[model samples]
Target: MSPYTRPSIAPQVFVDADGQVIDYGHRWSDSPPTEAYSVTVHPERYAPLHAVAAALIDHLRLTYDVEVDEGAHVVADLLVAPSWDVPRAVRVRPRDPKCAALTFVFTAFPGVIVHAGLLHDFPYPLCGCDACDTTWQREADELEEHVFAVVSGNYSESVERRDGEPAAWYQVRFANGSSGGSSSISTVAPERLEAAAVTLPDLPSGWRPWPLRHAAEA
Candidate 1:
């Protein structure tokens, strides 16, 4: 939890000085958490985000047939692209991987990408300074905001992917008449992105896809 040390888990996921999403790994090394982590020092040791994720999953099970991996509920990056590593990508195996589920990105904004076609490009600076620490809290708030946005349907979001060059011009638009995106020059290029959309029957099961949805909503 020290600003100088890597938190095994923060309130939510965020990228590190390196461009990888912080997860329950060996902490100092690049290795993922071993099986012992789930029992002894699980990453959700940061209880706030864990509780939030758990609550959403509990809510979903009330109406749907939800199945989760034995220890699927862990603190990890919501896999978008290899380069779009802004953490807060929490996941619980509610469905088959990337078949018909959406992705939730709580980095630049609370974006619930309905499909992989919508690329999310954000800043992944190599700096690990106090200034970035301050920025971290502000950006990390997106997770809570995303939950609120999805549950209440009160979010204004836009997805923009980098284009043209590494950090140069980025072309932005939407399937409908969408707007709002980042124009910062300090961004890593987006690699491939692919995720599943939660398959929802058209019976209006009291729930449907929103422009931005949490992983639980899937």
Candidate 2:
């Protein structure tokens, strides 16, 4: 499936200097004057984009406590030009009069090139604002509430085994009784179903594995 086909969701992103994403439901604004340094990955090197993006994000989080949006488009601020060359580095100067200019650099070895001094500071603190805190809490609360909802039966589920596979697939019915959503749940042994069930979300949620799908399953 194409990466852009999914429903609208918050990007797995860390806002530049604000320490918080723009907003959960809003789009990242590129209104302010900004500069972006991007590298066009040769088609042969395309497979590494995921790892490159991930490494960049990890570097930001580990070194600067900055988080990029999870959505591929949003993470690289490529919404308008979704197919724009993958951004290896991005710098934003928010239109807000109070914000400061910030830069981000992403690099991976063996093929990905590292821009010198691309990251303004090797280690920096995430933005600490009431808005940031509230955004963080909102995401956390939504997740916790959804998990409880699923475990409490606000959502119902059906299990079916694929014809050729040993795994069972799960179809979840939301609290509102909506259908059309499903996932593979074959990896959770029967013994651990209960424990796994408690972690699944029943609400409209993000990309996180709800109902506890094992990583190995992916």
Q: Which predicted model would earn the best TM-score?
A: 1
Candidate 1 residue-wise lDDT, 8-116, digit = tens: 3445565655768644323434433353332322222233433344444444344333343322222123223433324454332324322222233323221222111
Model 2: per-residue Cα lDDT over 31-109, one tens digit each: 3223321322122222233343343334333333222333233323211122224445554332321222233333332
Best by lDDT: 1
- Whole-model lDDT per candidate: 0.31, 0.31
Could you tell me the lDDT of residue 116 within candidate 1?
18
TM-score of each: 0.30, 0.24
Ten-residue region with minimum lDDT total, candidate 2: 116-125
RMSD of each: 14.5, 19.9
